[model samples]
Target: MFPSKSDFLLRLTTCLLSWVSALILVLIVWFLFVESELVWREVGVLRFLTDDRWSPSGDFSSAQFGLFPMIVASLLLAVGSILLAAPIGVGAALFAAYYAPRGVRQIFPRIVELLGGIPSVVYGLWGLVVLVPLISAYHPPGTSLLAGIVVVAIMILPTVALLTLSTFQQLPTSLIHSAAALGIAPTGIVRSVILPASRSGIMTAVLLAVTRAVGETMAVLMVCGNVIQAPSSPFSPVRTLTANIALEMAYAMQSHRSALFATGLALMLVVTLLVLIAEQQRGKAGHV
Candidate 1:
């Protein structure tokens, strides 16, 4: 049978959009590579990645561009945000999917979606004004790793919750009904049936949230104190790879600029890996 006009138009439009997106991504990676090649030649990949100093300017003797601290800070911030956001987001998703009244089910999701729509800069400002002051009451400097983590967690919470809720909503009603008929308690049905069935989707949601946390710049830059030191504790100030690039890219020149491009390349690589992993999990979820 021939495809209808609407169907053909829809397929053509989607295919064109997909190719455009792929082309744009390729251009970005190519730009990063061309710009960063100079630094790669001078610094060597191992030292550029593993060294703990990031002084891009000094006498040729003492200048160092170690990224270990920023790398560590980025990992800590992303992981910490995931740790804090996952359980809360998942629980809220479960409540929305399985327990909420119809009105609440409608309103709550919109509220969460609105949270996601809020600008990153606004979140940064809020963190700096409200969260930083609150933390400063207990800790000396308000801006620290803890503040960054909290801000990121809040920023990603809506993403996780909405995605997880969609995952739960996708479960077959018949399967849930069968479990109910078999005398499983509601909680038991959730634990043994719903959770296991939606595991891949939940993992995808969590990974996507982690990706957002890893790539977040403005909020983290504002709250993380921009200190290029490995964090000793959650209260310690530290700079992340994204924050480092954003902070330095404006004034950087020559090798300094190239190094910042290298930092962006690193960030791109990390986010790309995460997106690929999430896509894999999403594919598995679709199959299940």
Candidate 2:
């Protein structure tokens, strides 16, 4: 009877915690909507999105409020980071899971954990001091779209690698042994068996890494030059949406504050789209 009551209490606690988390998320979405209503009405969604300028603090009569440049910049940073990090992260996971010596396999996870544990600010500081100078030596200014991509990629690499490694480790050991007994080489086994088996998990890991890339602020802000412009080249200085919000939110007021909230709303939309895409992919993989 006591065990039954304890089990019921545990279930109740978990249920309540889940509800609280969902409620918090809903409240945040509501707050963003309420705060962003002014900008949505005042500027109109079309112009706010299409306008090239982003001078919300300009004269009240002619203050320009646009998101194009920042949006492009943010997209460039996120996409670039994903492209660069995905292969490296996945490769690291594969190596750690299959190719590494036993001693190295044990240590590899610890290294990945340490990378994940490092603070974003430390990564930012490292980018500002070390990476910037390295890039600056080749390009006149070190902080550019490329710099942001590299920093964000570094920040998200551990997330991808760690998640992928966990997924790889969870696979049925007997399946791998069977492939090996069939006289398949390790590489062939990985290609034909491991890769196919882990596709869903790999996709999920990439999705999470992409989200981290999209939302990263401090490291990208420090290295990306923070200029409000479309990212035209690897060397082009640009500002991401997250960086813009962080840069302006503190001093924003009235419509400006609402505009920042609108930016938050945009980010939420991006994340929602990502979730939808991931779900679609997950469903397709399940069917396969």
Work out the TM-score per prediction. Answer: 0.92, 0.90
* Tens-digit per-residue lDDT, 6-79, candidate 1: 88888889999999988998999999999988888877788766666788764434668888888889999999
Query: In candidate 2, where is summed lDDT lowest over 10 consecutive residues?
Result: 279-288
Q: Which runs of model 1 end up more than 4 angstroms from their true locations?
A: 1-20, 50-52, 58-62, 286-288
How many pairs of residues collide in each model?
1, 0
Q: The CA-based lDDT of model 2 is what?
A: 0.87
RMSD of each: 3.3, 2.8
How much does candidate 1 score in TM-score? 0.92
What tens digits encode model 2's per-residue C-alpha lDDT throughout 1-288?
A: 547988999989999999998899799899999999987887878877766688886444587888889888888888999999999999999999999899999999999999998999999999999988999899858899998899899999998899889878988888899999999999999889998888888898899888888889888888899998886679988999999999989999988898899999989988878777766665553111
- Whole-model Cα lDDT per candidate? 0.90, 0.87
Q: What is model 1's C-alpha RMSD?
A: 3.3
Worst 10 residues of 1 by lDDT: 56-65
